[model samples]
Every structure is written in C-alpha cells, then in structure tokens.
Target: MKLANVQQPIRLGAMTLPNRIIMGSMHVGLEKLPNGVERLADFYAERASGGAGLIVTGGAAVLPEGGMGEVYCNVFLDEHIEQLRIITEKVHQQKGKIALQLFHAGRYAYKEVTGLDPVAPSPLQAPINRTQPRELDEAGIERTIAAFASGAVRAQKAGFDAVEIMGSEGYLINQFLSPVTNQRQDEWGGDFGRRTRFGVEVAKRVREAVGRDFPVLFRMSGLDLIPDSTTIEETLQFARMLEEAGVDALNIGIGWHESKVPTISMMVPRGAYVWVAQQVKEAVHIPVIASNRINDIRHAEEILQAGRCDLVSLARPFLADPQIVAKSVQGRFDEVNTCIACNQACLDHIFDGKVASCLVNPMVGREVEWALAQATVRKKVAVVGAGPAGLEAARVLAERGHEVVLFEKQERIGGQLNYARQVPGKAEFNETLRYYQTQLVKLGVEVRLGTEASADELVREGFAEVVIATGVVPRRPEIAGQEMPHVVMYNEVFEHKVKVASKVVIVGAGGIACDLSHLLVHDEVISPEAAEYLLAYRILDAKALHKLQTGKRKVFMLRRGKHVGTGLGKTTRWATLAYLKQNGVEMLTEIEYKRIAEEGVYITRNGEEQVIPADTVIIAAGATPNDALYHALAGRIPVHLIGGAKEAGELDAKRAILEGAQVGRAI
Candidate 1:
C-alpha cells in the first residue's frame, strides 16, 4: 500500500520519515498542561512504536488570541520549550518524526484571552460565536504574520522535525482565502486571487522562518464545503500557489467548522477529501495528503492506487489502534479494535473535556502505560453472535491469550450490523467486520459460521460458560398504517429486499431514522451519486445530504414525544436539526402516528390531529429484543443476553464486552 509505505523509512525532505504513515494533526485541546503533554507523549510514542512514520501534533497556538483553545496545547514561549521537547524526544526514541502545527486562530480565538481583538479580513466572528470582532488594520495584519513566523521558528527550536501551518478547516488562513468569511473590499478579499494572498504570504513567511530545506507542511482546504466560498477550481489554483511558495506538502482538508453543511465537514465518507488531494496533486509538484472519515486500508489503497493522493491521513483509526499498522503488517488487522465512528467515544469525550479515547479501543490515550491483557493467566471463552457486540467481546477475550470460539447463525458475520452496513456510504462499517474476522482467525477463536452454538450444545460439550448475543428486532410502529403495503420498516429498506415506492416517507428521528432520511433521499458522501444528491437542509444547517428521492420527494418524520431524541452526539445532533430544517424535510414532532394512507400519514401533534401528505411510510421507531433463542434456553439453562437483545443498544456494548471479559477472566 503506497500510504502504508509510511510504516517503513522514507525521505521526507530534511527529515528522514521513519515510515510513510503520518498521524495527521488533530486538535483535541491537548496542548495545555504537563499531564496533557505527557498524555500526548504516550499517545505518539505508542503510534511511533506501532509503525507511524510521522506524528503531527495537534494545533499549537502562535498567539493567545489566535489559539484554537485554552485547553491542552504547547504554548510557544521559552518557558514551555522543555515540555514540548519532551514530546519530540519521545517520538525520536522510536525513530518517528514529530511536527507541531503552528496556528493562529485569528478570528476564531477568544478576544478576552488575546488582550488584542480577534482579527480577520473582515469584522466577522464565526456565526456561532456571535461576538463582534474588531477588523484587522494593516499593522495588525503584519503582526499576525510575524506571530505565525515566530511560532514556526519556536516549533523547530522546540525539537519538532517539521512545522505544519494549520490553514485548513476554515481556520485563519482559510478564513482569509474564503469569500464567505472574507467580505472585505481590500486586496485580501473579493476576488479569489486577492483572497488567497494572506495564505500565500503566511506560507512564504513560514518557509523563510523555518529555512529553505526544513520541510513545511501546509494544511489547506480542498473545498470550503460552505455556501458562497472557494470552489474546487480555486482550491486547485491555491494548491499551485502553495507549492510555488516552497510548501513541502499540502494536507488537503475539506469543509469549515460551525457550518450548516458540516456533516460534509466532518463525515460522509472515509478519505472523502481524496478528490481534493487529487486536484491539488495534479497541479502541484509536492505531495498531497488526504483525510475525511478515512479509517479503512482498502479505501486508503484505492485513493493511492488511483493516484488521488500521496498519503492517507487517519484520525479515528489511529485512535482505535495506534498499533494498527504493525498489526496489519502481521496480518493481525482484525485483532485491532475497530472504531464505529459513533463519535460517542472520541469526539464526544473531547467536547466533554476528557482525553480522547476510542469506543472500540479504550486504550487510545493510555497507550503509554496500560495493557488490557494479563500474559501469564488464560481462560476458555465463548462468544455467541458475530455482530458488533459479540465480535468486540470475542476479540478482546481471545487477545488475552484465551481459547475462544465465536458462533454465528448466518454464513456471513455481523448481526444487526450487517443490516446497518447495507445503507449507502456505510460500507466502511465492513471494516469492523474485517477487523473482527481477522482477529478471530489470528487469535484462533474457532469460528462457527452458519451454525448456532446452542446452550444445550455448550453444556453437552462441557463448556464452562456460555455467552448469548442474539441482537434485536425492529418493532413495527403500532398505527393504522401498520399493515399498509406501501409502508415499510428501515430494516427492510436497508436489507434491500423491500421495494421502496418512487416517493417515500420515513418516520422517527433517531440516528437510524435521520440516517435513512439522508440515505433514501440522497446519495452517500462516498458514492459517485453524491454530487447530484447534495441537498441543503434548511432545518439543521449542518445536515447536508446527497440523496435525491425519485419522483417529487416528501418525507414526513412523524413524532409522538415531547422531545425528539436524536441519539447523535450533541454537536452532530444540533447540526442535524439545523440541516433537516434547511433541506425542507417535514418533521412533525410531538405527534402520534395515527394512520398511513396512499396519500401520506395521518398524525396528531400536541393532541391535535393532522394529516400529512406522503407516498410511502417507513418507521425508525426503534428495535425490540431479538431473543427467541434466549427464551427457549432461559429455563433450560443459564443464559446471558447482551446488546439490543438486552436493551435496544442502550449503552450495553460496554456491559456486553465487560461481561464477556469478566466471564473470560473468571474462566
């Protein structure tokens, strides 16, 4: 794999990249305290050991006003040099290259902390901030440029092998380059050429500050993913200018933070930004790095093999398994825990003010010192069902040096997860299945596909313990449309067996429901149809979609509750709401499902009856415990049920994995 070539040594300008894979910079507010630095040191050291060629530390503020935040970050002052050095030295010990992203949040920074006003090409604060920012004067602009140069020099002196300018994600440099944010009449705004000047100046100054041969990585947006901003063609021109300025590489980024279309900003597909990389690479002489929901090797390979980008940057995958490269090399990829992108684990944890961790790999931040397994002791374990829960359970147990067996009723693996993966742009979910399958094989967890491991068989076989992970069933909503031919459940739609009408209406507002609304009505970010399906959701400004429902589309999301539970992360939920509204999606909340007709759905909102127009009806109400198998064995034998079978996927994966581990620990 060209990207995987990072696992071995390669020349990266002045720095010899110990490998090809660069753990791209991700700011989780990790640059503040000694402990944060220590946590980061452990984080990088583990990846370095795991075979990362380079580790780019998260954004470090050049000036207090331009800082990403006040949390974890290395302040480029003389006082903090030693602390930053500690991180660089740790990576060096493993022959890894570590670069620090020199950043100035510019307008994104907090004015109170900077002692100076947050400055931008215009007097605009990011819409969310609602803060009235002071516009930058010519002198102030010069100072800001100097600040960036100083920050780059400080990073190089702090022992970083390279310095990457954080110009992507609608950051300062991007803010200057974008018409959406840079509404100034001066040379720094208006036309694309003028708007790009700040970024070009910043790059030139940064290179001069760091010296000609000292490898400087420029992070740039491939597409703003924002309305009324730079287009793909302009982005290509910027990439050329970036290279002409002596930039070593461009870490291509897409989208702006705090936008109505941020789903396109943060998610949609793994390596979704590869196209931006390709565009830039085609016009530039330097390397182009791509990222965006990228967590699978096969997808990464496609991007490289297709010559889309020079490198694939993985944030969550590396978080899930810093040792993913090493394990994959040994063909032990499945043994590496897979991230579900539930974002519940890492992103949610970060916003909630905790060090980042993977929902699948809880060991992400603790890699400097902790291990989940005990080498000397061992046990025999059985994991029933091969879905996310059961698969996670079996992998962890077997890795503890336990003798394990995983049973599945289907010829294929994955339980409910298989259905979930059938949705468009969700194929990456197969990564989890692949990881588990590989791990089970490598760990020698005897797999019994197309066979059910009945408790009776386990008992008769003299097995010490039995684990049951039967999963769940989707409950049909109790309504007049319950048996309607045009009505269908998300399960049926996802399974691809159910024939959807040319026009369809999806009910419910949880994760799956919203996902279906996005999918059935639009193309997934990864699909070729994405360009045509992109729809601007007026309800939730952040909820941008690509699917276009055949025929004139009308989806009625019926509700019967006081509050709609998004079941998405807080940020994503708000973003979704804003998007759905913006896209002209009909959401009838606090309404009861009364009936379904050929025309649409009949509903009652706040106790008042309302009839909504629809062509076909679908339900995302929820799931029921799929436990017929468990019920038969309950009285006959002791049976433990996990996952949806336990409580509709209600925070029970942890419970299931722990139960499997504890049961293994005891055995």
Candidate 2:
C-alpha cells in the first residue's frame, strides 16, 4: 500500500533519487527532425513536473548510421549540450533527476532508415529488420565502444544526472552475447566471457569518461527468450560481470521484442518480466529495476513487496499518463490514464517518422503544445450516443463547468469498446472504459443508459451544443444467399466467438475479419489442441481437455481488396499475417467473392473462377455507420462523428476516447 513511502531514497552514484520509480528508456521513435531526437526540454521537463524521480529519456543515437525514425534524438555532439543543459536545468528546477540512455542500433538498424547496410556482431540478421546486416569486425566494434563512451561524456557535459548504457533488447550488445547471432570465433566470440567483452568494455570506458562517482545503469535483457539465445543462468553470470564491470544498477528487461510475439512487446499480462528482475535482483547486490508490460501499479507494488526488484520502471504507462506518480501518491490512481497498449500511435506512427503518441493520451509526446479549457459561458451540452466520443465530449464540457447530459442506446457506457474487450490479448482495452467512466462521473456529467436521443429532445432541452458520436453498424452485404443460416456478419462471430465445423472460411482481410479468423483457428472449439485453442473453445469440449494448447490451426482467408490488407500498423499487420501463415490459413488475396452456396464459396482469382470449401463463411468486409441521428440533426445542430462512423480505423478504444475527448474540449 505504501510502496513509495517505504522507500529510502537510493543513490545513483553522485546524484540522489527521490524514490525507486525509474522512468525507463523506451524509444517511441518520435524524433521530429533529421536529428532523430526528442526535444530535451519539453519532454524531460514534462516528466520532471509529472513527479518522475529520475527521468531516463528514450534511447539516443550515438552515431549517424544508428539514427532511428525522425529527429529530436539527442545525438552526442558538443552543439547539443546547450539544449540538453536547458532540459536538465528545467528538470532540476522541478526537483527531478535525469539520465541519458545511449546506444547504437547495429543490426537493429534498417537499410530504409540508415541508407547504409546494417552492421551486426555477425551476418545473422535480426528477425524484424529486413536489412541484411554486415558483420562487425574488430575495428567496427572498437568504434562502437568509443561511440558509447562519447555519448556518456556528452551526457555528463549536458548536465544529466547519469548515463544509462542500453545493452539489451537484442541490440549490438545482446547480439554479441548470444551464440545464435555471434558466430565470430575471434576475441569477441565463442563464449559468454568473449560475448560480454564489448558491453563490459563500453561500460568501463563510459565509467572512465564520467568518472568514478558518476552512475552508469546498464539496461539489459536477462533472457533473450528466443531459440539459441542466452538463457537466464548465462544472463545472471553476465549480470555479475557487469556489476563487477562497474554498473551501478541493472534495469532488467526481457524477450527480444522484435522476434518474439509483438503483443508481448507491448500487451502481455502485467509483470511478464518480474521474475527476470527477481532472478537478477537475487544475483546482484546492486539495485535492480524491472520493465516490460509493467503498467499496473498494484502489480508493481506486489512485485516490490515480494522483493522481485528494487524499482518499477514504466515505459508505455508513463507515456499514457505523465501524472501517474502524482496521482498515485495522492490516492487518485483511478484518475491516471491507463495505457491500453494498442500500439496504434506509438510504434505504428514511428514507422512513419511521426512523433510518439499514445492511444489513450493524445497529449503524450505533443503535450507541451496541446491544451484545452472549460466553456467561457456554462451552457447546456447534449452528447448523443454513450460511446467514446460522446463520453469524452460530455466529460470535457462538464469539467469546464457546463451542464452536460450523455445518452446511449445500450445499457452500458462503452460503445464499440464494449465488444473490443472480447478479443484475446485485448482485455487491456477496458482501461479506457474505466478511465472515461471515472472521469465522466467525477466531472458531474448526467449519464443515461438505454436512451436513444431523437432530434426533438435536443431542441426541448435547449442544448447550446450537441455532439453525435453515432457509431457504425455492420452492413449486411448484398451477396446472394447471405440470409443462409451459415453466413454471419463479422460482429456476430466476434460477439459470440463460437467455433463451428472443422474447416471455415473468413471473407474479409481487414482487422476485424482477421481477428475472427485468429479466434476460430487458435481457440479450442474451432482448432482444439487434443487439442486446445482460441476463445469460447473449451465450452464444448467435455473430455481430454488439456491444460495448454500449443497446436496451430488451419483456416482460409478470402479477400476482395486488390492490395489484400489496408489501414493497419505494419508490425500489427505483419503479426496477423505471420499468425495466418503459422496457423496455415490459406489466403486468397485479391479474390472476388461471387457467392456463398451450400457447399463452398464461389470466387474469382486473377479473372478466373475458383471454389473454396467451407463449413462456415464469416463476413468481415464492412460496417455501416449508425448515424441516423447525426444525419437528421446535422445542419440544425452541431454534430461530430468519431471512430468507424468517421472512418474505418482499427476499432481502437484509445483512439476513440481521445478523439471524443478532443471534440468534447473543443465544444
């Protein structure tokens, strides 16, 4: 209950920390300029004011080739010191300490971004990177070591409290640490000691540059969680060597985020890596910090109580709400904007060289310039539709001291968000629901359930402003025999999540249809593992129900679009593709669906007719926006559309909520 209160301030070498919470370094890849670094003053100053005891900024490029995404990354140069100094001064003024995380991406570098071929410990390419990296030789390795030291010296000069060496996440250091990637037989390979040489040398040189009293925290991965990667035992031994090599602390992160399950990269169950932190904490006398999917403070408290690690380092969660620390300290944990971990804005946007943005918190990286105010005159505001946009608008207007009323046709507050939570690995979506519910109630918005608003009601209430968040409705396609009992809309499949028949065909390549395909293939009812699989699966299986189902599934994907897929983030889009491939989903991309008959689906492939057998056809192609209210009231009253009603986005609650909030504040 008293996690931070019980903490005695720990020392980070010469600098002292206020508490055990370390804002760990995570690259949203949101640097705005060719410089590829976030502005030090705006970002660090925001975190400092948000009560970050020690702010560890995102990883900065140490060299030109390692520059990722866009500009604003603090490149280690003399000219940047004045800017960094101004940032450090702002943080210090707010009574916060700061650190710089330095790194060279190496094989993690991309040909598209870097222009030059990537360089790795060996020729073995990192899984996510399409770029085949050139192997680093002795000279290249030495240059990298010097680059890290130079970054540390720059941090020291820029008035950073400390410098963190990022030797984890399968970067250059981990590549060398693993036999899977480190094929070199020379001085830097063949064994753990040799593999750790580059990292240890970097730490030593950085420590030497920053001096003995300066802190050097090594952010590392205890286990790569990939085949032929370093195991926990080997990583523990490596941790000891780092402590011996003069690292003041170890920030333990897990799994090569790029190769393994990307949802694990963002949305694994909370505390997925606490055990890794616990193991390292037991192995090292120095303070230990645990990261990776650590958004829940209750989970953080439990980990600390069990002595898993000395500190909780939040990445996505901090970005979701910078005021987490102050709110948690004030017992207003409910007010904290919880990260839904959708990765829609952060990772996906980064691929486009855009600044980091949170699904739930629209003001995340752009906070310094974004704000809103209450109404100058407290007028009545009516929000039609109790979905994300409606809730956000009502909450904003009410908070600004206006009378607000919210109406939903459903019995609950959440709109499409209600169904989004039904998907596997998407239970975290409820965080947005909790956020809006708390804010709406506290802000004095009158919420009415099961109330469908007619245009006349608005005029009766004399509302000065009306926001219609009328959402989308699933449109029944004009396909012949659609009324056949077997043909179902994408929403029905997702809502019921029941598996029928051994072989099925999903007729839509978009995200919703894709989600249904995954559920049917992976769930037990459809692709049971003896078998066990996706969602409502075990409900039908009465016997031979095993504990875990690792078996893959077989299904079919029918797409009519010329490009196959559109409007999805790359990593997520890739993930769905990989799953379909891994699960043996036969995809008929760019195929036209002629009709669904008794036995199978008739289609056209490359102007030729083809038939695919299926026991069930799941329709996932499109939805109709349920905007009768908006249409009827459009010119007479003010109305704004959000989510699918506005456009076909990935049906993310965070985006909906933020859009709603944005509109609400504007109103």
Tell me the TM-score of each prediction against the true structure.
0.80, 0.89
Clashes of 1: 42
C-alpha RMSD in Å of predicted model 1 compared with the true structure: 5.9
Predictions in order: lDDT = 0.71, 0.75
- Runs off by more than 4 Å, candidate 2: 4-8, 33-40, 111-117, 123-127, 130-137, 263-267, 493-504, 521-555, 562-567, 577-586, 605-616, 649-655
lDDT of 1 at 659: 48
Tens-place lDDT digits, model 1, residues 439-539: 77777888889997766677676544456776777877677757767778787777776876646667777777776765565533344444333323242
Candidate 2 lDDT by residue in tens digits, 252-367: 86767566556343336777668888889999899999887877666677777778888888877778888787777677878888877767777777766666777777777565
Output the lDDT of residue 153, model 1.
86
